[model samples]
Target: MLTPREFYVVIERDEDGYYVGEVPQLKGCYSQGDTIDELLTNIKEVIELCLEEQEESNKNLSEFVGIQKVSI
Candidate 1:
């Protein structure tokens, strides 16, 4: 069996009120949905597709450190 891997998803609500999700570890890996739950489900599928399309040997996923808020 293959080992399970975890990924960090960055989610944001767009101006149109859709929830958008993106995986920083995988370039161009993203998805959207009407609700948070739906977004999560959709993003999971997208992640799977991205993983399958990438060559395992060449896959270089970045570690998720943390997100910070900046003050102007």
Candidate 2:
């Protein structure tokens, strides 16, 4: 068994002032929006879609197998 991968994500404003989001841990996972709320919603949907795709394909979500972080 393995623990779920969780990492930080930050949304930034692009040249056209559009909200662009990226998941730091999941390479190439990104989304764009016209507003902050939309950006968050879009990113959530994107994450879900990515996870679902991995599940359907029977792929391990994370490429790493070692413990990333652990609580004391």
Candidate 3:
């Protein structure tokens, strides 16, 4: 059995009111849906697809450090 890997996802609501989600670990891995539940489901599918594509290309996933907010 393959060990499950954890990934951090960033979600935000766009101007059109669609919930957009992206996995930072995987480049160009993103998805959108109307609701949070749907967004999560969509993002999961996107992640799976990205993983498969990455495997085909033998791409390496970048390490996620953290996010920060700065006031200027």
Candidate 4:
């Protein structure tokens, strides 16, 4: 059996009130849904599709340090 890989997901509520989820590690991996649960489900499917299209050369994902806010 293949070991499950863990990925970090970032979710936010957009201006239209939809929940948007993104996998920062996977470029262009994003999805949206009306609720958190739905967003999670949608993102999972998107991640799977992205993984399927991922090439061996693109498997080296960058390390996620952290997110910060800056005020002027």
Candidate 5:
């Protein structure tokens, strides 16, 4: 069995008030929900789908680095 992988998600609330979540490690992986709980659930499903698709291509998942905030 494969070990569980932990992914870092960047979340934001759009102008419409929906919570949008994106996985930086997985390219083109994102999902939105009405609430945080829903968003997380949806993101999990999306990640699974992305992984299956990646299996064929054998793409490498990027390592997660810490996020930083900068002000000009």
Candidate 6:
């Protein structure tokens, strides 16, 4: 059976003034653009790749319990 997975993204502006988007779940899945629209488009691909990676990784990790703690 197929399972669902989730991932996180972290976007920021760099010192050089470019918008940087990163997929934390998938290492090296990142992109930068001069504008928000471009960044979003680029990041969409980045996110998809991240999701694919998460699915691959889940093959080994899915058996373990998943938990998260956050403070807001």
Please, what is the whole-model Cα lDDT of each candidate in the order they appear?
A: 0.91, 0.76, 0.95, 0.87, 0.96, 0.70
TM-score of each: 0.87, 0.64, 0.95, 0.85, 0.94, 0.54
Query: What global local distance difference test value does model 4 have?
Result: 0.87
- Candidate 2 lDDT tens digits, 32-56: 9999999988998888787777678
TM-score of the candidate numbered 2?
0.64
Q: What digit string (tens of lDDT, one per residue) describes model 3 on residues 1-72?
A: 999989998999999999999999999999999999999999999999999999999999999999999999
Name the best candidate (by TM-score).
Answer: 3
RMSD of 1: 1.6
Candidate 6 residue 14 Cα shift, in angstroms, is 1.3
Model 1 segments beyond 4 Å from truth? none
Q: How would you encode candidate 6's per-residue C-alpha lDDT over 28-56 as one tens digit per residue?
A: 67899998789879988876776677677
Q: Write the per-residue lDDT of candidate 1 for residues 1-72, one digit (tens) a residue.
A: 999989998999999999999998888999999999999999999999888878765777777788899999
Error of 1 at 35 (Å): 0.7
Output the number of the lDDT-best candidate. Answer: 5
Model 2: lDDT of residue 32:
90
Best of the two (3, 4) by lDDT: 3
After aligning candidate 5 to the native by TM-score, how far in Å is the CA of 22 from where it should be? 0.4
**Model 5 residue-pair collision total:** 0
Arrange candidates by TM-score, descending. 3, 5, 1, 4, 2, 6
- Model 4 alpha-carbon miss at residue 19, Å: 0.3
- How many angstroms is residue 43 displaced in model 3 relative to the true structure, after the best TM-score fit? 0.5
| Candidate 3 TM-score versus the reference | 0.95
User: Where in model 5 is the C-alpha error above 4 Å?
Assistant: none
